[model samples]
Every structure is written in structure tokens, then in C-alpha cells.
Target: MQIILCESAEQVGRRAADIIEARVRQGPAVLGLATGGSPASTYAELIRRHREEGLRFGDVTAFTLDEYAGLPADHPQSYHSTIRREFVDHVDLDLAKLHTPRGDAEDLVAEAARYDLAIVGAGGIDVQLLGIGANGHIGFNEPTSSLRSRTRVKTLAVATRTANARFFEGDDEEVPKLCLTQGLGTIGESRQAVLVALGSAKAAAVQAMVEGPVSAFCPGSVLQLHPRATIVLDPGAASQLTMLEYYRDAQALNDGLQ
Candidate 1:
């Protein structure tokens, strides 16, 4: 695990984008994308590069991390629509190649199984982008989720639902109680994983993910076991990490080497 402390949230986004852009430039590649505010800036940065720097994603195949159960693919609040609006529509990515879990499938169980198979068929993800939930959940894998879990339906916690209430006109009741999410085991299979966080609101969760013990209670801590996981954060988010100076020193050394 590598902790990269950036001076600001925009830098955190750019750093995350750097990892993704590098993967896309490496011939044909697969990407696992995240939704929500943490990755919004990263998507914006990628869009800027596409327009201004000639960064192309024509050969990239993308997969989104999760979706709200019962929401149609075209629903504005659904991850399917959100991802397209936020990133896909701005890039040259092939719409046919981008995959998202069918949250509204009549047979949701089968949908989850099919989604997992689809990922395997695409050669798995080359790089997976993630956002640590304020409660330390990744995707919709709430605390106590099995570390070896696969793609499946999950019940969203109260906190998770409340946090997402903004997308549903600030009504927690409007937020779906269930969701479909790629599990830790599935995410761990990626060649690399990049997680970005910002602001003081994320400080405790960031600290727990980076410096705390590996446990199901804090699902994001599973990244510590990943062979190629990178945690990008702004100062506010990294404030609670005990090895703050060490991480900064190590990142400086790594930058010099690069």
C-alpha cells in the first residue's frame, strides 16, 4: 500500500487521474470506475485531458463499481447515467464496451452473476478506482461484508443511505435500501487499485483505512492487503494518519525515483 499525500483535493484528483490515464495509454485496457463526490474531480480532470491534451480512451473498456437497486439504467440518479454524464460522454470511449451492473434486472441475483462473468470475460480490470465511504465502506460493501465476497446484492447501511440522500433530493427514504456492488474479492483481482479521498470529513475513515488493523469492520482496510493499492489524499484527509511524515518522506523519495 502506498499513501500519497497531496496539498489539495484537486491534486488528489489529478494523481488518481494520472494512474488511470497511464493505464489507458498502455494499449487496450480495462478500468473499474467509482461514483460519488470523491471521484467527481478525477472524472473532471480526465475530461479536461481528453479535450485539451489529446488523451484518448478509444481502446479502453470501462466498468462502474455499483448501482442503486430498482433504478432504471436511464434514471438520472443511477450510476449508469451518472457515469455517462460525468465521464463517458466526454471521452471517446465506446459505449458498447462500457459495462454497468443491471440494477433494475427482474432477476437481480442472476444479474449479479452475469456481471461477474462479464468482468472475467473482459480480462478483468487493469485499474480499479475507488472512494472510501465516510463509514469506510467500498462500493456498497458495508461493514461486516465478507472479504472474499463476490458481485451481489447488498443492504445499504443507514449512514450510507443518509450520505447518498443528496442524490435523491435530500430524502433518505428516496434512496434505495439495496444496491448491487462489486465485492472486495472481485475488486482485489484488479491489477491495480487507486483510492482517492479529500476533506476533513474523511480524516477518520482515511486513518482507519491506512493505519488501522485489517478487519471487516472497516472494509476499506482490505486495500492494505492489495499488492498494488494506492491511497491518494489531501492534507485534511491524511491528518489522522499516524505515519504522516513517513508517508510524505516516502512519497518524495518515490517522486524523485520516478
Candidate 2:
């Protein structure tokens, strides 16, 4: 695991985009994408590079990490729409290559199974991007989620629902209570995992994920088991990590090695 701290959210976004652009350049790559306010700036920077620096995504295959179970793909609050509005629609990638779990499947269990099969068939994700929930959830895998879980429908925790309420016009009741999400094990299967968090609001969870015990209580901490996981944060988000200085020193050493 590696921790990278940036002075500002915008700088973190640029740094993340740089990593993504480099991955996209390495031939056809499968990318695991996340949706939320946290990744908006990174997508914006990617769009900017696509426009100004001639960055191209023609060979990339993208899969979204989760989706509200009952929401239609066209719903404004659906991850499908959010991803399209923020990143996919602005890029030149093939629409046919984009994937998201079927949120409205008649047979949800089968849908989840199919989603897992599709990911495996695509040769697995090369780089999985993530946004840590304030409650330490990743995708929709809330507290106590099985570390070895696969694609499945999960009930949203009250904390997650409340946090997401802003998207539903500040009405917590409007947010979906159920969602389909990739399991921690599925995310860990990716060759590389990149997580982004910002602001003091996420400080505690970020700390727990980085420095606390690796348990289901802090699902994001499961990243500790990934072979090539990287946590990128703005300083405020990284505030509670006790070993922050050591991380910086390690980064300096890695930079010299590179």
C-alpha cells in the first residue's frame, strides 16, 4: 500500500488523472470506475486532458463499481447517468465497452452473477478507482460486509443513505435503500487499486483505513491486502493518519528510485 498526500483536492485530481492517462496508454486496459462528488474533479481533469493534450480512451473498457438497485439507468441519480454526465459522455471510448451492474434486473441474483462473470471474462480490472465512504465503505459494501463477498445486492447503511441525501434534493427518504455493488474481494482482484478522499470530514475513516486494523468494521482497510493499492488524498483528508510522515518519506524514496 502507498499513501500520497497532495496540497489541494485539485492537485490530487491532476495526479490521479496522470496515473489514469498512463494506464490508458498501455494498450487496452480494463478500468474499475466509481461515482460520487469525490471523483468529479478527477473526471474533469481527465476530460480536460482528452480535449487539450489529445488523451484518448478508445481501447479502454470501463466498469462502474456500483448502482442503486431500483433506479433506472436513465434516472438522474443513477450511477449510470452520473458517470455519463461526468466522464463517459465526454470521452471517445466505445459505448458498447462500458459496463455497470443491472440495477433493475428481474432476477437480481442472476444479474449479480452475470456481472461477476463479465468482469472475469474481460480479464479482470487493471486499475480500479475508488472513493471511500465516510463510514469506511467502498462501493456499497457497508460495515460488516464479507471480505470474500462477490457481486451482490446490499442494504445501504443509514449513514450512507444520509450522506447521499444531498443528491436527492436533501431528502434522505428519496435515496435508494438498496444497491448492487462489487465486493471487497472483487475490488482487490484488480491489478491496481487507487482510492481518493478529501476534506476533514473523511479524515477519521481515512485514518482507520490506513493505520487501523484490517477488519470489516472499516471495509476500505481491506485495501491493505491488495498487492498494489494506493491511497491518494488532500492534506485535510490525510490529517488523521498517524504515520503520515513515514508515508511521505517512503514516497520520497520511491521517487528517487524511479
Candidate 3:
């Protein structure tokens, strides 16, 4: 695990984007994408690069981390629609290569299984992007979510609903109660994982995810098991990390080595 503390949210995005650009350039890349407030800036940076620096995605295969259950694919708040509107639509990629769990499928259980199979068939994710929830959840894998669980349906926590209420015009009741999320085990399969967080609001979750004991209580803590997990954060987000100075020094040392 590498902790990269940046000066601001935008800097955090740029840093993560640097990794994404490097990975994409390595060869055909399978990307694990996530949504929510945490990754919004990273997506913005990617879009900026696409428009200004000719960053292309023709060889990329993208898979989203989760989708709200009961939401139509075209629904404005749907992950699929959000992905397209905020990231995919701005990039030059083959639409058919992008995949998302079918939130409104007739047989969602089967679809979830199929989604897992599809990811494996595609050789797993080269690099997965993640965002820690305010309550320490990753994707929609709420507290106590099985560490070895696979792709499946999950009930959203009340905190999650409240956090997501802004998307529904500040109505937590309007937020979907169910979701399909790539489980911790599924996320661990990725060759590399990059998690980004910003602002003081995320400090506690960031601390738990980076330094807390590996436990189901803080689902994001599962990232500690990943062979290659990068925790990118702004100073505000890294504030709660006990070894902030050490993390900064180490980052500087690593930067100097390059």
C-alpha cells in the first residue's frame, strides 16, 4: 500500500490520472471504474486530458464498480448514465467494451454472476479505481460485507442513502435501497487498485482504510490485502492518518527516486 498525500483535491486527481495514463499506455488495459463524489475530480482530470492532451481510450475495456438497483440504465442517477455523462461520453472508446452490472435486469442474481464471469473472461481488471464511503464502505459493500464475497446485490446503509441524497434532490427516501457492487474479493483480483479521497469529511474513513486493522467492520480496510493498492489523498483527507509526516517523506523519497 502506498499513501500519496497531495496539496489539494485537484492535485490528487492529477496524481491518480498520472497512474491511469501510465497503465493505459502499457498495453490493452482493463479498467475498473467507480462513481460518487470521491472520483468526480479524477474523472474530470481524465476528461481534461482527453480533450487537451489527446489521451485516448480506444484500447481500454471499462467496468463500473456498482449500479443502483431498480434504476433504469438511462436514468439520470443511474451509474451507467452517470459514467457516460461524466466520463465515457467524453472519451473515444468503443461503447460495446464498457460494462456495468444490470441494475434493472429481470434476473439480477444471474446477471451479477454473469458480470463476474465476464470480468474474469476479460482477464480481470488491470487497475481498479475506488472511493471510500463516509462510513468506510467501498462500492456498496456495506459494513460486515463478506470479505470474500463476489459480485452480488447489497442493501444500502442509511448513511449511504443520506450521503447519496444530493443526487435525488436532497431526498434520501428517493435513493435506491439496493445495489449491485463488485465485492471485496472481486476488487482484490485486480492487478492494481487506486483509491482517491479528498476533504476533511473523508479523514476518518481514509485513516481506517489505510491504517486500521483488516476487518469487515470497515469494508474499505480490505484494500490492505491487495498486492498493489494506492491510497491517494489530499491533506484534508490524510489529516487523520497517524503517520502523515512519514507518508509525506516517503512520497518525496519515491518521487526523488524517479
TM-scores of all predicted structures: 0.99, 0.98, 0.98
Predictions in order: lDDT:
0.93, 0.91, 0.93
Pull out the clashing pairs in model 3.
none
Candidate 3 structure quality by residue, lDDT tens digits, 1-258:
999989988998999999999999887999999998888889999989999998889999999999999998999999999999989999997889999999999988998899999999999999999999888999899999999999999999999999999999999999999999999999999999999998899899889888899999999999999999999998888889999889989999999998
lDDT by residue (138-252, candidate 1, tens digit) is 9889999999889999999999999999988999999999999999999999999999998889889988999899989999999989999999998888888899889989999
User: After superposing candidate 1, which stretches have Cα over 4 Å from the reference?
Assistant: none
Error of 2 at 162 (Å): 0.7
Scored by Cα lDDT, where does model 2 land? 0.91
- Give residue 192's lDDT in candidate 2 (0 to 100): 91
Best by TM-score: 1
Flag regions of model 3 displaced more than 4 Å: none
Minimal lDDT window, size 10, model 1:
236-245
Each candidate's number of clashing pairs is 0, 0, 0
- In the predicted model 1, the residue pairs found to clash are none
Rank by lDDT, descending? Answer: 1, 3, 2
